[model samples]
Target: MAETIEEIASRVRELRELSKVTAEEMAEYLKVPLETYCCYEEGKTDIPASKLFEIGQRLDVDMNLLLTGEEARMRIFTVTRKGEGVEVERRRQYRYQNLAGKFLSKKAEFFTVTIDPMKEKPTAYSHPGQEFDYVLEGSLKFYIHDHEIILDEGDSILFDSSYRHAMEAKNGRPAKMLVVVI
Candidate 1:
């Protein structure tokens, strides 16, 4: 069975308890309000991918442990067949399929992202890493800080994820891209 948001939240809570960390500490680490962090822990709100990543990192565990409840045992290489990667439902407008979720000690996280068409660009988010996005289908409006760039099929970009960034599907259609977070 696929992992549910509540199940992930329960795992996070259990891990936090085992690590002897307090909810207040996690909220401060994520730079989010106490209420917002509590909602994530309670599974009352969807947790952003970046925040989840941060939590996994701070807890000294791979994101696979958080997402799948399974430690990565593949040290050589793990191949995820087409349409076979793990899906992350972190946001309403974005759908992410994790490509290398089982790879141990990966320097980066690989994901295939699908962006649903929307009239307005959502709020930008930042994380402590670099990001690369390669457009595979349709068009995407990419925003990095004050700059906005339209990426068509086959186009790609690299930027610092620590800077505020957002992505929006264009032309009343969905967009697909390969994203690498390092």
Candidate 2:
């Protein structure tokens, strides 16, 4: 089926409800009026690209996901830092296959993400937690719902992971990012 603005808006509204965040609160987060925010969610008004990007950032969702409703989940493998060189833990694999959901463990969560230049757009994941991401190399386009931000080498963004969000490599360049969810 062809995608429609209303569909995107409705999905976003559903995600917001799932997050247990109210429209007024989201509006506060976006620094927009409640009515305007409602209009975006209701699809009564066209969302500006930049504003949509802001909503994505505030909601912690991937702009593309919000726009296309496509799945971007994946299985990521990485080595534990305390180990010699690399030790794989089958249980600790990072799966972006679904919503990260609530953190079961109080301990810190970490994931090593690698983006290939030729790969399709990455999926968006959101949960109720805090996150810190540091770029190891190259550049990435970070989308928290409609919001898009670029991070170069050594750049980082720390924010609540509860927002719907996703990330992608810019210019088809390979990028590596270390994500810590707490």
- Best-performing candidate as measured by TM-score: 1
- After superposition, the stretches of candidate 1 with alpha carbons farther than 4 Å from their true spots are none
Once model 1 is optimally superposed onto the true structure by TM-score, how far is the C-alpha of residue 25 displaced, in angstroms?
A: 0.7
- The local lDDT score (0 to 100) that residue 47 gets in candidate 2 is 57
Candidate 2 structure, TM-score to reference: 0.43
User: Model 1 misses residue 128 by how many Å?
Assistant: 0.6
Tens digit of per-residue lDDT, candidate 1, span 133-157 = 9999999899899999999999999
lDDT of 2 by residue, 57-170 (tens): 666675445555653343353332322221111111111111221222214445566565545565565665677889888888888867899999999999877687777777
State residue 126's C-alpha deviation in candidate 1, in Å. Answer: 0.8
Q: Which residue segments of model 2 deviate by more than 4 Å?
A: 1-106, 118-120
Best by lDDT: 1
**Which stretch of 10 consecutive residues in model 2 shows the poorest summed lDDT?**
89-98
Q: How far is candidate 1 from the true structure (C-alpha RMSD, Å)?
A: 1.0
lDDT of 1 at 72: 84
